[model samples]
Target chain A: MLVVSLIAFVMFRFVGDPVDQMVGLETTLEERAKLREQLGLNDPLPVQFWNFVSKAAQGDLGISYQFKRPVAVLLSERLPATLELSFVSALFALLAGIPMGVYTALRRESFLSKLFLTVSLIGISLPTFLIGILLIFIFSVNLQWLPSFGRGQVVDLGWWTTGFLTVSGLKALILPSITLGLFQMTLIMRLVRSEMLEVLRTDYIKFARARGLKDRAIHFGHALKNTLIPVITITGLQLGSIIAFAIITETVFQWPGMGLLFLQAVQNVDIPIMSAYLLLIAFLFVAINLIVDLLYVVVDPRIRIGGAEA
Target chain B: MSDALLSVRDLVVEFPTRKGILTAVDSVSFDIGRGEVLGVVGESGAGKSMTGSAIIGLIEPPGHIAGGSIELAGERIDNLPLEAMRKVRGKRIGMVFQDPLTSLNPLYTIAEQLIETIRTHLKLSERDARERAIGLLDEVGIPAASRRIDDYPHQFSGGMRQRVVIALALCAEPELVIADEPTTALDVSVQSQIIDVLKNMCAEHGSSVMLITHDMGVIAEAADRVAVMYAGRLAEIGPVRDVIQDARHPYTKGLMGSIPTLMHDSDRLTQIPGSMPRLTDIPPGCAFSPRCPKAFDRCFSVQPACERHEDREVACLLYDEGGRP
Candidate 1:
């Protein structure tokens, strides 16, 4: 996380001046110098970095250069939209991916399995931006069913504002979430399919069959649980990636998420938002991996002993 | 054979490939009498395991029972539908795999595995099934059965796991248990313990066992009767003592010779001249004929039918009344 903070801090420098974006060319040099001083941009490099880190640790992320608002408040407002989109996308990916994978694995020669494999191949092959554009083109321009831009009709609930309560907000989320989640869904599906295939061939599965276990018990109860050990780790990391990489989907739909905020901050050399976003993404990845490690203990007993000893 | 608990007649298992259909078990036949321990010994690819798989209806796709019937306690199970066959499996015919490490699901507790198997084939409640599982565990000689039943497979040592496997197989008290190399993967010291548990438990349950292994010592110790397979065909079969002491088939003699005996003064263990023939390249005559030291003109030209000589069935031209020199 500190390494990411350092990188984000370095990005704050040498990526053009926030003062250039803040003021027009007619502003006097003295006025510009005063503004830089006021923002502590005139401080030594190490001192500026120390101040950034210390203040960030205390929940103060300075202020956004373009919006003239506190960076923490800006992020918190956009945070809900991004989190909701990510949650939906992650849920969509897993719920669709796992069963699709198991189906393809169990019925390797079936027509539907082949069709799913083909569609997933397309899902994996196409870039996120292209999928997002194609979705917008079909759903917004051609069919005119959903709005093309912005979060619609958010319902504020004191600390958090959410789109889930409104019909239009939920409808607007469908395209972007699908566009964001499609790649991850295909990835998880293929992973699960291969894992299920491998698990099905294991001696335990054969023994389960020989024990006269029902087909459902053998497949889901025995084989599927074993297959999920690796799937959990992959899905956890993918969840992090989905949130971190939602920028393309956000850009295409013009959704009011942190990715869009990050984009705007990057364009205007808004150091506070840019650095804070980087640090936040890093923290999410670490936190997700920790949860995945803990989940291993729950699913597999062999890991439980090792975890206890460790 | 008339009083057999499980009988297999002219069983043919084949695997179809792009080139041609390969006959893995070519018209093999055998029987396990009630409470009998029938040890099946052979080299790798001898179809000993395939025969066991055929009985349980577990022959994988592209490989299948090409011909012959399997009867379990007088009912034709070979031609039964998959759903019917499944019911016959754990309830009437249980199986023990070679690797205890991989046989039990690592994710499940031993109690969970055993209770499920018991409940699947019986009408016991969960608590009753659990108690039965624990009882079987104790019977199989797992120390602290009641407490350790909830432990995962990985928690048990190799020998203990095999014991657990035996307990699981015997929990439902099936009529037949096809234990395929049940002791092959254990320690030398652990091997006898596992074999003893398997044999004693089956004997107690009156469950017929078709013990498949390549270990001659195991067959000598555990088998009431022994069957030797040569390239998917039964080379010879008889009472274990008769087959071990006075083998009739040339292949069976060669197999007995290869075993290092304390009584034999020979410096080197005898080895058969060639490996078992692959399914694709099996000779037109008896599969062992090409490698048989006693091979002659008739042996090369004619496939020998099994000839009954006293208590043994030998597939050799030498045993034929008219074909013999």
Candidate 2:
């Protein structure tokens, strides 16, 4: 985490001056100097980096010059949207991908399996923005069944707000979520298929068959459980990538999420928002890795023993 | 033999390859009476393990039973449908694999594996199944069976794990158990203990056993009868004492000579002249003739049929005549 903040600080510092974005090229030199002083842009690099580190530790990210609002407030508003998208897409990917993987692995030579493999190949190879446009064209423009862009009507619940409560709201989420989730789905499916293939050939699986376990029990209860260690690891890492790649999907769909906010902040050279975004993403990745480690103990008793011993 | 618990007759297992069909087990026949132990001994690729797998209907894909039949308790099982066979497998026939680690699922507790198998084959409630699991574990010589039942495979030592696998194989109280090199993966110090546990527990359950291994010592200690396989063909079958002391087939004689007895101290153990043939390249007539020290024109030209003499059967032209040599 410390390393991530240091890298973010260094990278943001090297980018073009935030002052140029704040005050236009037409501003007088004396006025620019005064504004730079007010923002502490005149300080040395280490002093400026230390100031960012101290303020970030207390969750006091500075105001975004473009919006004239605290970066924290802006993030709280947009973070939930991104979180909802990522959570839904990840859930969809896992629920669909794991079963599909198991089915394909069991029937590797079947026509349906081959077709699924080909479709997933396209899902992985095709660009995210292209998929978003294609889905929008098919579902929105062609069928006129769903909205083309933006989060649907927000329901302002006392504790939380979401656009997923209404019918049209769900319709709006369908295209963007599918567009953003397809790649992860394909990735997880391929990973799980390969992993299941390997696990099915293991001696324990043969033993399970010998024990007269039903085909369903052997495939799902035994083989699938064994395959989950690698699947969980890949799924967790892919979850981080889903959030990262949502930037492209959000832009294509014009969704009100952190990815869109990040894009606009980058365009305006809003250093505070950009740094806050980078730090939050790094923290999310770390948290995900920790969760995956914990899941390992839950999935495999051998790992649980090692964890307890450690 | 008339009251045999399990009967396998003229069994032929074949694997179809790009080149051709390779016969892994050729015209093998045997029977195990109730509570009997039949040890199958052979070199690697000699089809000892293949015969066991064939009997259990566990031959891998592309390798299948091309002929003959298997019967359990007078009912033909060779042509049963997969679902029926699944019921017969753990309920009537149990299998103990070569590697204990491979035989047991690492993710599940011993209690879970045992109880699942018990419940699958028997109409036992969860509590009753768990009780049966613990009882089987105790019968197999596991100390603190109740506590150890909840432990994973990795938590047990190699010998203890083999004991657990034996417990699992017997949990359903099947009529027959096929143990393929059950002690091959364990340390020498624990091998005898595990073998003892397997022998005692199976005998107590009144289950017939087909033990497959390349180790002659294991066969000597555990088998009531012995069947020797060479080049995927049964060379000899008889009581363990008769086969070990008075082997009639040249291949069986050579195998017996190779065993190191303390009384016959020698610098080098007796060795058979040539290795077993590959499945695709087995010789034309008697597959063992190429390596037999007593090979002759008739031996190489004729595939000898199993000839009975006294209480044993030997597949050799040398034993074709009625009188004993």
Clashes per prediction? 0, 0
Question: Per-residue lDDT for A1-310 in model 1, tens only?
Answer: 7888789888877678878978988999999999999989989999999988898889888788788899899999989999999999999999999999999999999999999999999999999999988888998999999887788999999878899999999998899999989999999999999999999999999999999999999999999999999999999999999999999889988999999999998776788799889988998899999999999988889989867877
State TM-scores per candidate.
0.98, 0.97
Candidate 1 vs. true structure, TM-score: 0.98
| Global lDDT scores for all candidate models | 0.91, 0.89
lDDT of 2 by residue, A1-310 (tens): 9998998888677788877877777999999999989988889998988998999888877888799899988988888788888888898899889888988999999998999899999999999999999999998899999999988887877645687898777777888888888988998899899999999888888888888888888898898888889999999998988887789999999989999999999887887789889998998999999999989888889978977888
Which predicted model would earn the best TM-score?
Answer: 1
Query: Model 2 over residues B54-77: C-alpha lDDT tens digits?
Result: 877889998999999899999999
Across all candidates, what is each one's fraction of true contacts kept?
0.85, 0.74
Per-residue alpha-carbon lDDT of model 1 for B1-325, expressed as tens digits? Answer: 6789999999999999987999999898788899999999999999999999999999998899999988988889999999999998888998999999999999999988988899889999999999898889999999898899889898899999999988888888899999999988999999988999999999999999999999999999999999999888989989999999998888888889999989879999887898888889999888898899999888877888776789878899998988877
Model 2 alpha-carbon miss at residue B138, Å: 0.8
TM-score of chain B of 2: 0.97
Model 2 ranges off by over 4 Å: A24-28, A158-160, B322-325
